[model samples]
Target chain A: MKKLLKYDYQYLKRTSKFIIFPVVIIILAVLSPLTARYLNEILAFSLGDQAGMFNFPDPVVFDSYVEYLSNLSDIYLYVIIFIGVGTFINDKTKGLYPLILSKPINRVKYLLSKYMTLSSLIFVSLMVGMLVFSFYTYYIFGEVDLLNVFLLSLLYFIYVELILAIAMFSAMYFKSYITAVMITFAGYILVSLINVFSFEFLKYMPGMISSNIIQVISNSASTPDVIYNVVVTLVITGLLVVLSITKFKKYDLN
Target chain B: MDAIKTVNLSKSYNNTLVLKQLNLNVKKGEVYGFIGKNGAGKTTTINLILSLILKDSGQVFINEEEIKFSDLAFKKLIGYVPDVPVFPSYMCAKDYLRFTLDIFDLGDSMVNQKTEEILEFVSLPNSTKKISSYSRGMKQRLAIAQALIHDPEIIIMDEPTSALDPIGRNDVMNIIYKLRGSKTIFYSTHILDDVERVCDRIGLLDDGNLIVQDTVDNIQKNFFSNKFYIETKNEPKFVLKKIAKINQVQNAVKENHGIVCYLEENTDENTLLKKLMEMDENIVEFRRVKTSLEDVFIRLTNEKTT
Candidate 1:
């Protein structure tokens, strides 16, 4: 398993994935806070005479956190899903399996390596993004809650991990990148839709993760609910990973 | 011990049986050439043996031990090269080899040495040109190099040279020739010339069935013992007509520069020669024809169809 992880890291490095994810995240990290800080001024400048008619609210440090979290949820997650599915499916698509699988590597370890590597990349990038966003928010808005921002990034990271598991499972199940990406997107939508239901059990589901991130940043989230959602999401993600490995063991690389 | 064995191995696609009851026993330290036409289940059998796909029913044994699906231990003892070898294009030749060695857990002590040695063995440059920049032939050689780096007991190659140019084919064949006695090679190819040159034994697979399997010499001697060829100074067309009338010649056909006759059982060779002499034929060449692997493959496949 350690050996597989070493090679998987090399794969990420060689493919420039190590650079792509963090750079994109950092750019988002910088842009998010800046966008939140200057939207009124930028909009007024663009609108010119028309800008006088509309009322613009004052920007706050919390708006910066919201902007960063929203980007993490929407754009960053989309990038993660797209690239994650490709990483899982490209070995077969590129005809690397017959040689790679013909080695002594275990199928489960082979998969877990990819999952762990990509998960680590996301973890590290989110950490970097969090620090950058917090720094920029403090510089512009005079005060930033580092702990709250940390918790927000942590919750968002957990949510991204769940999405990645879905991507891996879909890649193995469908074996086509386009289909896998679509299925992963559908999974994300299904979870979001489930969050809309007012059922008590649904509060602990993965769909509530996004809204929960907002609540965590705003400091109104129920600690027990967040803990329950994290545990349940992790369990479901683990199950999906197992399913992916199971499907991959029988995958036909013809 | 037989390095690789498959018994009653079978597979199907879309309910259509593509490989049926394939039982192969490739002995240790011998180059076994698996010859078949395109879509004749050659790749399918290799895939099943390597456990890359689920088999319908059968047993594959490596070094006499039975194998199961998702088995990794057996893979450690085997190296496989697909027909079209694809690598991670972002990596250079040495990078791929090092990765392969790392996958086998070959220690860091000799990694650089082994990587260099294998790259040199396959004639690939040790530079940093990514695999995407490699030509087809280079990729094929790199495939062999990776397969050999681990020093497995057997190497299963599925049509490694089917897509190469003449020079590339020769380069790969030479590598196989160099490793002939050192490793058990289960080579699959549609190129009969390569089999004739490199294989000690040959298996002719027709429509997923192992129709014929034996030493290349034995297969030829068994199937074409009665066949002989004669090249005449004449037009040869008239010679064929005359030879076809002879009772001892069961079948005679005009081939390039000659007439190929399949003699009747127990017929004396001199009878056909004496009859040709009586026809005032100027025979420039006349002898028993050494049948090629191509001939045997064609005859076996045709015989099965008929």
Candidate 2:
């Protein structure tokens, strides 16, 4: 398992995954705060004559957090879904499984290695993104809640985990990159749709993770509800991982 | 003990049986050529033996130990090279071999030395070109290199040279020849000529059934041993026609430069020779023909189909 981890790390490094991922997240981090800070002026400049017609409210540190969190849930999550599906399915599609599986490696560890490696990359990239967002937020807005940003990043990272889990499950189930990506997107949309339901149980679904992340940034969340959502998401992620491994074990690498 | 054994193994796809109850045994320290045509379940059998696919019925054994689908220990005893071996494109040959070593938990201090030594065995250059940039032949050499890195007791290859040029094929065949006595090689291929050159024993599979299994010499000797080639001064066509008239000649046909005759069972060669002299045909050369592996494969497969 440790050797597999080393190979996965080497894979990430040689494949430029080590650079592309963090660079993308850091770009989002820098752009989020910059966009949140200057949107009003930029928009006003665009509407020069009509600039006075609309009063633009001042952007706050909360808006920067909101921008960053929104980017994480939208763009960053899509990146995760696409890359995650590719990583999971490419081994099978590209004919890499027969060689790798022919070795004396456990199926469970083979799978977890990829998941853990990619998840670690995502975690580190999120942490780096948080630091960048906080620095920019402090420089521009003069106030940055480090703990809230940290918590928000951590919450968003958990959501990233769920997305990756769904991606892995979809890749294993569908075995086609496009189909896996489409299925993961469908799963994302289905979870979000469940979030709109009025049922009490629906509040703890994985979809509520995005809202919980926001509540953390704005300091308006119920601690118990947040805990419940995290627990339920973790449980679902675990189940999906189990399902992926089971399917892969039975899969014919012909 | 057999290095690899399959008993009553069967597989189906979409309700169509691709592999029937196949009983195959590959003995240790021998080159077993698994000869089959396309879609003859050769790869399927390999997959089942390696636990790469689920078998609908029966069991596989390696070194006398029954194998399960999830068995990893058995894998340590065997190495596999697929029909089309693929590697992580981002890695060079040394990197990929090192990764394979890591997979087997053989990441010792001699990893670099072992990698270089195996690479040299396959005749792969020691350059650091990424595997993605390699040609098909180069990838195949690298595949063999990686498979031998751990010095496994058994090596299973599926059509390793089916897609290579003559030179590449010869290179792979030479490597197999070099490893012949030291390792058990379960080589799967439709290339009968290579099998004739390298394999000690063979199992011919037709429609998933083990139709024939024996040593190369025994199979050839047992199959159509009475076939004789007669070259005469007369036209081959006329010779064939006259030969067909002989009672001892059960069948006669004109070949490229001679008349080939299949003598009836218990027919003496002297009887046929005397009758040929009676026809007043000047015989230039007359000798028993050695049946080739190709001839045996084609005739057997055709007979099975008919």
Best by lDDT: 2
Instruction: Give lDDT tens digits, candidate 1, residues B225-290.
Output: 778889988888888889999988888888998999998768868888899899999989988988
lDDT (10s digit) by residue, model 2, range B26-57: 99999999999999999999999998999999
Q: What are the per-residue Cα lDDT tens digits for candidate 2 across A1-254?
A: 78878888888887787887799989998898899999999999999999999999998888898888888888888888888898888888888888888888898888999999999999999889889888888998899999999999888888888889999999999967999999999999988788688798699999998888888777889999999999998999999999999988888875
Clash pairs, model 2 backbone: none
How large is the i-RMS for each model, in angstroms?
A: 1.4, 1.1
- Classify candidate 1 by CAPRI docking class: medium
DockQ per candidate: 0.76, 0.84
**DockQ, computed on Cα atoms, for candidate 1:** 0.76
**lDDT against true structure, model 1:** 0.89
| Positional deviation of residue B232's Cα in model 2 after best superposition, in angstroms | 4.0
TM-score of every prediction relative to native: 0.94, 0.97
Q: TM-score of the candidate numbered 1?
A: 0.94
> Clashes in model 1: which pairs?
none
